[model samples]
Target: MDAQLIAFTGVSAGLVAMPGADFTVVVRNALVSRRAGIACALGIGAGLLVHVALAVVGITAVLAAVPALFRALQVVGGVYVLYLGVQTLRQPHSPVGNPQGGPTARPLRQGFVTNALNPKVSVTFVSVLPQFVPAGAPALPRTLLLALIMVAVALVWFQVVALLVDRLGRWLRRPRVARGVTAVTGAALTVFGSALLAGPLRALLRAL
Candidate 1:
């Protein structure tokens, strides 16, 4: 493998592994059921594919160019994330197999929406990924190849996280433990979402 490719792969792995909304969502759903966890992982993979397609076609570049549009997207993403966090916090603790269901009930869609709305992913594609593509290289093929590598890495990592969470299901699914986990993840999402919204919101308030 080319040195740059290797470096890109390492960087991608590190980025995907970072604990963020995706990680929290996966863990929360994984606590519900292994199937749900895997489903969520697959959904995240699909979201990554969408981002890759958009980035490769230069749509993300357009978003980057339009500050207002990008900030609008960031605000939307933040609100969505904040909503999810509030919903999570409000969720009543239920048994692992409760038929009433939760986000885990549609883990795939939840995961997809969570990831798809994240502007940071688009930014990464627009900014970080391009650095790895050699100048004057056949941009299309090379970029696709690199994107595939990133998607694969992310899928594998999340799947492993889900599997591991499943392995610890016995303990994590307990009433008290599950409630604690829920609280932590919910709070995390809230904070993350707030941070995302902070800058744009401040700008908006200033303009007003």
Candidate 2:
């Protein structure tokens, strides 16, 4: 059990650290304000909990079983991310400001929706959690424990990112650099959305 827990933690750490929509969103919010970044992280943690619950209840498996529904979800999620990227790219960049450390509901909601809508996230939880469930053990408690560990690790990593980016708040305040950061993140988001769409888009085209 200990070995499985350690292995799950290590694998989850690697997954959490990978550059993705979550990382890009955090960096973007962090550059805006430390509070915003932290809010985004908390929201993502909340979203992770949702995924974990769904996986534990076997809802994720049901979603996966319905191919059309799953594909539709992927398409919607992909298009939404792509839209965000395009909007970010088009928006005029501004200096990082001292946004009042309160009223950060938007960023929080943004983080939650982004993670929650992602079919891949659902798939990952469904696939990964089963691998570590110990033989002869009650699956429910073990799965929940693993999920909690993943969320804990993710929260720590995201908070670190938020703090680090906030520390560089000054440099990011520069108009040019700030714009550059936005552009890079925007491109990254676009790429992520495109990757999600590739197979589905290809299939759709063939069916046309």
By lDDT, the best candidate is 1
Runs in model 1 lying further than 4 Å from the true structure = 98-105
lDDT per residue as tens, model 1, 1-208: 9999999999999999999988988887787788888889988998899899998899999988987888888898888878878888888475555323355448998788888888789889888888998999998999899989999999999999988988888788778988898889889888878877997889898889
lDDT of each: 0.86, 0.85
TM-score of predicted structure 2: 0.93
Clashes of 2: 0
- The positional error of residue 201 in candidate 1, measured at the CA in angstroms, is 0.6
Write candidate 2's Cα lDDT for 25-102 as tens digits: 888788778999999988888888888988889999998898777888788878877877887788747555664455
Which 10 consecutive residues of model 2 have the lowest summed lDDT? 92-101
Best by TM-score: 2
TM-score of each: 0.92, 0.93
